[model samples]
Target: MVKLRLKRYGRKKLPSYRIIVIDSRNKRDGKAIEELGFYNPITNETRIDIPRVLQRLTEGAQATRTVQNILDRAQLIAKEEN
Candidate 1:
């Protein structure tokens, strides 16, 4: 299974994360299929590739809880039809 999750990086006490698509069984930070965005908590900065994210999601990629929240904040997901 493929998952959309955060990969930690940067110096100690100043962490940042790369939103990545990777195999569920792989080690954390081992490798990623694709990097979709970046998040810097210290600086409160975020960058995302919306089209790529949508494509991945459509292909059955599941996001972590934090990533899901980020996507919700960005309003990237379309509303479901009633």
Candidate 2:
């Protein structure tokens, strides 16, 4: 199964992540099928490819809980903007 999840990067104790689409069988930081967004927890900043995220979701990509929350917030913000 394909899933949407965070892949850690950046320096220790100052982590950032890429929101990625990857196979379930792979490791946490394994190669991804596609990259959909970026998250920086320390700064509470997010940069998402909303359209591509919607496309992947429609195609049956399941997201992790944290990613789901992020997506929810992003979608809400997007709705407000439009």
Candidate 3:
């Protein structure tokens, strides 16, 4: 199964994440099938590829809770842009 999830990376105290499409059984930081966006919790910042994310979702990619929340925020941003 393919899942949309976060891949953690950065310094010890300051962490950032790349939202990626990866295999469910793979390690958290394992090789990703595709990178969809990035998030920084400290700054509450997010950057998402909306079209690609929608595409992946339509194709049956399941998102974890955190990722789903990020996507929800992204959706609101996208709606406001237009």
Candidate 4:
């Protein structure tokens, strides 16, 4: 199964995450099929590729709880923009 989740990166004290699509059997940070967005928890910032994200979501990829919340918020923001 393909899953959408966060992959950690950045320096020791500061952490940032990439929202990625990968196979469920793989290790958390092993590799990714696609990177749909990024999130910086410390700064509370997000950058997402909505079209690609929606495409993957429609194609059956599952999101982790945090990712789901982020996606939902991004969708709401997108809707407001259009």
lDDT per residue for candidate 2 within 3-31, as digits (tens), equals: 99999999989999999999999999999
True-structure RMSD for candidate 2: 0.9
Model 1 TM-score is 0.88
Error of 4 at 42 (Å): 0.8
List per-prediction Cα lDDT, in the order shown.
0.90, 0.96, 0.96, 0.93
Better of 3 and 4 by TM-score: 3
Off by over 4 Å in 2: none
1-82: candidate 1 lDDT, tens digit per residue: 9999999999999999999999989887979999999989888788989899999999999998999998886674345532
Clashes of each: 0, 0, 0, 0
**Candidate 4, 49: how far from true, in Å?**
0.5
RMSD of 4: 1.2
Candidate 4 lDDT, 1-82, residue by residue in tens: 9999999999998999999999989998988999999999998899999899889989999999999999888889879999
lDDT for 18 in candidate 1 is 96
lDDT of 3 by residue, 1-82 (tens): 9999999999999999999999999999999999999999999999999899989999999999999999998888879999
Question: Candidate 4 has what TM-score?
Answer: 0.91
lDDT of candidate model 1 versus the reference: 0.90
**Which residue pairs collide in model 1, if any?**
none
Off by over 4 Å in 1: 76-82
